[model samples]
Target: MAEWTIGGVLDAIAGVIPDRLMTVCGQRRSTFADTADRSRRLANFLAGRGLGAHRERHTLANWECGQDRVALIMRNDLYPDAVIGCLKARTVPVNVNFHYTPREVNELLEYVKPSAVIYHRSLGAKFADVLPPDALWISVDDGGVLPELPSAVRLADALVEGAVDQRISPSPDDVVMMCTGGTTGRPKGVLWRQCDTYTVSMNGADHAYAAEIAEKVRHAGPPWFAVSPLMHAAGMWTAFAGVLGGQTVVLYDNRETFDPKAVWATVEREKVGLMTMVGDAYAGPLIDELQRNSYDLSSLFAVATGGAATNPRHQQALLEMLPGITLVNGYGSSETGNVGFGRSQRGDTRDTFELRDGALVLAADYSRFLHPGEQEIGWVARAGRIPLGYFDDPDATRSTFPEVDGKRVVISGDRGALAEDGTLRLFGRDSLVVNTGGEKVFVEEVEEVVRAHPGIADALVVGRPSERWGEEVVALIARAEVRAAVTHDVLHTHCAAHLAGFKVPKEFIVVEQVRRLGNGKADYRWAKSAVLREVTPA
Candidate 1:
């Protein structure tokens, strides 16, 4: 088989790798055997409920009929069995952001109108008002809350009794949808596939890294512990890469409420050899904790950072703190897999590019094949095994995967260029999306919320400098009244009504007037610089 369905992959792995220890969260250790057993039992439990293929096709259509896309609003449990279960039923998971507040959660439910939602019991209340009274809701009791929804099934019991059905296989064209695009609102789902997952591991850059790490894992314990949630692209790709290589993946269940101290303790206790992070938000806290405690971290083989740009200052500090440690700075995105080929030793070099068509070219920061006299910056494009299309959205699929002279190539929105020797230099995302920590917040979306405030006429939400969070959101509001003074506190409270926690501005800056082009277009460069000076101390 080119690639088995999500279920078949697990089943095959279980048969071949029965003795291996799979996932570790604190003291609870789940072996490959345990995971497979639980998954099978879970399948049986659902079968017992008359929810399997035994039901007539038309009757089954009553719930899933006309449903092209669905969301799996669930938390990370012992193993990601729900991801397998949903895929078995030919339903791609939306993987809704777990940090979404009740209001935001409700809005997404309205938008997707999923036939069914498999959520945690604690999250049941979050969906109470959002979901239709009769909409089918199955709360996976993660040993936390007792689910009393109309259609309730305690996961432990449900999994055991669900009947077994014909194993379904997913094709390469089938999607493993996660994050949303659209930049406007109600995020659109990004697509991936079983083949893509396997391909990411087998990809040139990733393959070399995995082989190097596997050798290290043979001599040492687990090579890495994923500090961030596996929901995001960086975290998910890194974690999955570890999984494909049979390296132990150590992750905390409570990444939603990040605790710097707990992370340190876990590192010390778990003997984490590699600590992978993407941006300055995680690096700042790690550096702070390293300073506070004189703990022995000799087991920590290296520190890898990617997903966002890291400042030279931050990179220098981290190297000084963890001398003799491998500090790798890499780059990639959800649409285009792992494009950044060069790895930074001290993390000083923010320059990134990928080997495309067997040559390293500019990713998004510089122009491709620069002319002798033409020195202007070029928008980056990676020419390689980028995805064919996005899930369900043909327009976006076309925008990213463009046709040049009838040849299709994926051009992610980020800008960059190639050097003479083909070393790729990547600029940060040029799409006007603010990556606060690891989460993406589109400026256009945030500006709409700021404009909703009665105190504002027009607004620009630009990323401001921050030592803690990689990028702090700053709203530069255009005021209508000459005497009105809009304070940061007032705007924060205003956002509590309409925006999610992550999207809300940490600090609000009042401007005499919002700078824009003659046609009311946002001048991002002007807004970015102005907000930086306004928020950052001199």
Candidate 2:
């Protein structure tokens, strides 16, 4: 049987294709052999300091982690190294949002109780006062913006040049923690076994042996450019999946912000084959860049957007500009890996996905699995190769990942319906659903119609308080230009044409920009607050 461990598979790939390019970020490039060596050294360093699996998965509860945790508070450059090294050493790597406020950072760190922290020098001050005193601090240089912590050790200095440690064994049951962005509420740590995460993240590309995977990767694919931040699951998983499949992974260099021009130039120069982005927050600017200037994107074949709501208008515009390119909209969450994906080409506008194996729609009440042709909306769910549960939250763990018909499945808050043909009609997150006058309206559905208008640049829909109706639908619109002729009546007319009368926005507030996280996911909390501030009497 295969080990099915990340370190084991990575080692096998390195043995087979030692000279293959593994990662490229700006001028820094690393081959598989070089990466493996560095990873082994880091693993050894951690192991020597007594960091490894302390207990097996079966020995601990679903929400409990027996392994030491390391918080990763850095950008894309050395992010993969930290994850690979921690896994190799049997230490769980927890993702920390670099864009988080001081209080948010402190709260997350306190919840995870990480034993060590790997951060960029630019962000040292944020963690200095909040980090656990006993935690090991390993800092990476980021233009030397902030002073280093008192007990910090440079990453380069910690690595020791030596042969791979033969005695260090990694288990398939070892945990890999992915922390949610806390956009809806407080962030919870979703924990998955190494084997399960590898299978799911690779879209169920599992083989019996590491040697089999190595042989299959003999002919490497074209380079994959990961434009999303590594702190997010979408970005980290895509980059890891690319390397595991024997493809060079290109990291986006703009650490502070997303620069579409620089991204396109890098894609042209590196000949990036597939680029991963997070919806309109990325696609809107990229479309603007493409319209303003042309680049040699001959090497680009596929552009995939995930981890957020992708505007159909942006998708169609991209398809029109890049002839013969496939626009893929991936559908999944941190709890359930890659459940389904929708593909679009030139002249195509629909956003329905064929559910993968072990994925289906549960009844609205979650009493049973809904079969194809179910007219009622339900929760989108996945059974096999799912996470163990959210760490340290037994109640949430049981509620999110429950047993149905004697089978364990994870329903990650997505509301959708199954078509007669078995395609999934996703209706955004259930948390974003607005109930107006006893009618449930999916915000994504309304936002789609509003953004389709030529004058609108982007829009977010939320429910605000109302005297008559339980809650009234409200839209926050950002125009394409300051002087663009976008009004509440114009948007209402456009939305009314495509949607039911109740789904139309009752009120519209023009804003400079729609609130979004660094990873392009909607900031619902921000939107709701903005709406409250606007509607509340002064």
- True-structure lDDT of candidate 1: 0.62
State each candidate's clash count.
26, 0
Task: List per-prediction Cα lDDT, in the order shown.
Answer: 0.62, 0.82
TM-score of every model versus the real structure: 0.84, 0.81
TM-score of 2: 0.81
Off by over 4 Å in 1: 4-6, 41-70, 132-136, 142-147, 201-223, 346-350, 353-376, 535-538
Q: What is the C-alpha lDDT profile of model 2 across 1-538, one tens digit per residue?
A: 5547787777888999999999997678998888888889889888877888888888999999999999999989878888889999999999987765565578789899988999998888855888788888988887765777898988887785224463578888999999873333366899999888888886435578776977877997679999988788888888898988888999987456778999999889989899998776688789999999999999999999876656667788899899778988887878998888898888775568977788988898878999889789999999988899999999989999999988899997888998888999988676776645334466876787788999988888898766444467899888898888877777778777666566689888888889899999889898999899894311
